[model samples]
Target: MPQPPIPVAVLTGFLGAGKTTLLNFLLKDPFLADAAVIINEFGDVGIDHLLVERSDENVVEMASGCLCCTIRGDLIDTMHDLLARRGRGEIKAFNRIIIETTGLADPAPVLHAVMSDPGLLATCRLEGVITVVDAFNGMATLDAHAEAVKQVAVADRIVLTKVDLLEGREGEDMLFAIIARLRKLNPAARLLTTHRNEATAERLFTMGLFDPTKKTPDVQNWLAAEAYATGEKRGRRHAHHGHHHHDHHHDVSRHDEHIRSFSFTEANAISPQGLELFLELLRSYHGANMLRMKGIVKLADDPSSPVVLHGVQHVFHPPVRLAAWPDADHRTRLVFIVKDIEKPMIEGLFKAFTDQISGGADAFTDTTLSLNR
Candidate 1:
């Protein structure tokens, strides 16, 4: 039997977000003994790899049975080299790979590289993204950096670090406000605190479709579609009222304003051709603005077996059809995290295509979409 693909997790955060600190803590834990780490740095002289508590050569063997290496060139070449060495018995065998991105990195390109690479796809699967947020400076970071907001928006798990520094009543208020802001940005992500020892390897990893501990597909946890649905409704209500709370807190959260996380659900099955046309038009028109999109589709032809779609920007993973529905719910659900793209535009485009497919109209030639509106 062919070996199953290894799970690859991306660890991202803004500068001084304590990503390295959290990584050090996780590396010491016994659960990540078989994990391999790839630390990516921008400059020629990499400091994060040296700071990882293991040093010797390009690939360092840790006492905890984890292999540590720095990116030699681009990420694609580096991953290929690592796999080559592992196949040649040059490094220890590891079941999991953790990629520590640079503090200033956007993380979308990193995900695009991983998801679009065919060679890597055969050997590895993207497990999830774990973004570390500094509780002390997270508010400011999110305000100043759009990248920081995108990091939190695309994360499967959000780890809040340096919570112990939040002292006094003012600090407590700041903590609560930041937490609320984070939930507003990405409600589906599981918020965790590092100070309380809540950010562990067990909680961080295995965040993909399959839950190893439960020995079953955790679709609800993976998608968290309900959370996005609730957030979408709340957003609509806020937009309808046209209420703006002009305050220091709201001013500092300017970046969060551009980000829109919402879910699009369909009660009936959709035609495969319609879904294809919808995705193509979406990618062509607003791929750059689309931060992330994940959904399970109920096909009109194969309603019993649903197809799951995951994408980062224009690059999307090959559609995988599950043998059966994970739960009783068979409706099509798609969750989107985008920047400056209105929910109405996406929903309208999808409806047009699906309606054309069902009504036997010329969807591709007749339909017109404009991002300006």
Candidate 2:
């Protein structure tokens, strides 16, 4: 029998945009009482989970820096575990799943994970993506942060949060102006306003990617056009190759030295133990230089089902196993966007590990994965 699809919702916004506040509100909603909540935050120390007021069992925290980064692997693992427990009747049956991402997260990868993961796709569907904007600081945030723009551009629904804080004459002007900006970035997403009313959740989650009845995502506007534009501006960033070249001769800083993107792939499928070792070395040698690293890896034993990996800085989340490949391209596609780090260094470290694994070395002999310990 086909398993029921899991509906996952990604909640994103700029820093201090009331994402946590909105999440807290959703948790208390009687209608959404049984929803599983996953919180992914940026920074070395994660406290957003603490800010969430929910019972311990239902609220899962992925503290590997950012949802779009280091802990992405962990997100998939957590979801799988949640599904297993729910299947076993160990937890309350949930009709929905909510993911609250850090201010700095890029929603593209998260969305990709939901859409591409065969396991998730078979049993789960993307409900919708909701982006919250701080009415008071919305303009400034959009102007100052690329991440903020990405968040708004990819949203299936936009929530104008903290309107009460902007109630005066000036506040009203800001609200209209921000709405105009969001409409331009994401023309398809339905706009909603939030306050103490708690109406945003209902509006935002009304749509889903795969409707059992409709057989298509009700929210059909392609947010990827915006992502493609940004990608063009970022040039053609290859996951294993590192920097994107703009025409002829170029002299760019290495991955660890400045902000850059790097790509790499393993010829043979990677072992689970090998992945664990690679993550540990990442924390030890290049943790501080990392911004975000995401990949769909080919597992040695489980080659049919690729293992999804995400990491931010030093923290590595557990791996997420997909049920099948999303497309024909099966090579592990790992994209690393880093600051103050070199691509060669990261690639070299991964190569060294593969060498050791081939030589019959175990985790104890893996010297690089020792940083976190």
Candidate 3:
């Protein structure tokens, strides 16, 4: 019998963003008791604290009750060796895999590798992407590095670390700004703040199509298109600005107008072909502009079930049709987190292809996209 695809989640963040802290927290879970963690060592960073036993030159078993090994060379090779060892019962038979990427590494390529590799595709599934953000330096990091921006944009979960450092009214104001900034970058992604408390591994671990337990996708929390469609998002944004504005201080969160999020809903069900055409066109012309796109579409042929689509950059993962709509109020809701792209253009292009998504975005104006700065 063939082995089921093992879910592999990539935990990433900028340097000093506390991914290591989160990883340590996650390894303590009983659910992940039989999981193999592959940690990527970049440059000369020492991870002696993470490993309790250096049984092998590269691999070590953590005292926190998990197996961890540093990727000494090729990631693919390391994974292959892991499976081979497990097959021979040399190592424990772990059912799950967690990959901790280097701080500055581009996570897209790691995702692409799993998607493209025939062997990894059959054995390992690219599951959730968890990105940690430093409450102290997150804003500065985003302003300075595009890599950091991309990490936030692609994450399934954003964990804000070092919030204990935030104190007083001034600190409170700064926290709001960073939260707002993260919201703008990825509204659909779930945000959790952790200073010293340990976040549940179950909450962060299972974010893919199905969890390790084989449960159905949590469409509501996963897509969260409603959060963007409703006025709640705008209210939250204004609330953030309100805090800074109350003190007569400038809003430091609006660092980059290029990266923004918007959503559009179509009342009528969309034909399968028409939906495909719109996506193709979107990816062909404005793919570079799109950072991430996800939606649960109501198919014209079968309105009873919804088709879920998720795309990163130009490359779209295979569309999956859920057994039923997540809720009763399932119209086609698509959310986009993009860079240097106006909402009107996407809405207009969507209209051109399907004539389904009507109306334009009021909050994200053309001027914001056209601004040189």
- The residue-by-residue lDDT of candidate 2 on 79-111, one tens digit each, is 776777778875556777777787888776676
lDDT of 3 by residue, 247-282 (tens): 544335533566777788877776788688778867
Q: Against the hidden true structure, what lDDT does model 2 obtain?
A: 0.61
Tens digit per residue, CA lDDT, model 1, 323-343:
898888888888899999888
Best by lDDT: 1
Q: Candidate 3 — worst ten consecutive residues by lDDT sum?
A: 359-368
- Residue 265's lDDT in candidate 2: 64
- Scored by Cα lDDT, where does model 3 land? 0.75
Kindly indicate the candidate among 1 and 3 with the higher lDDT: 1
Global lDDT of each model?
0.83, 0.61, 0.75
Q: List the residue pairs that clash in candidate 3.
A: none
In the predicted model 1, the residue pairs found to clash are: none
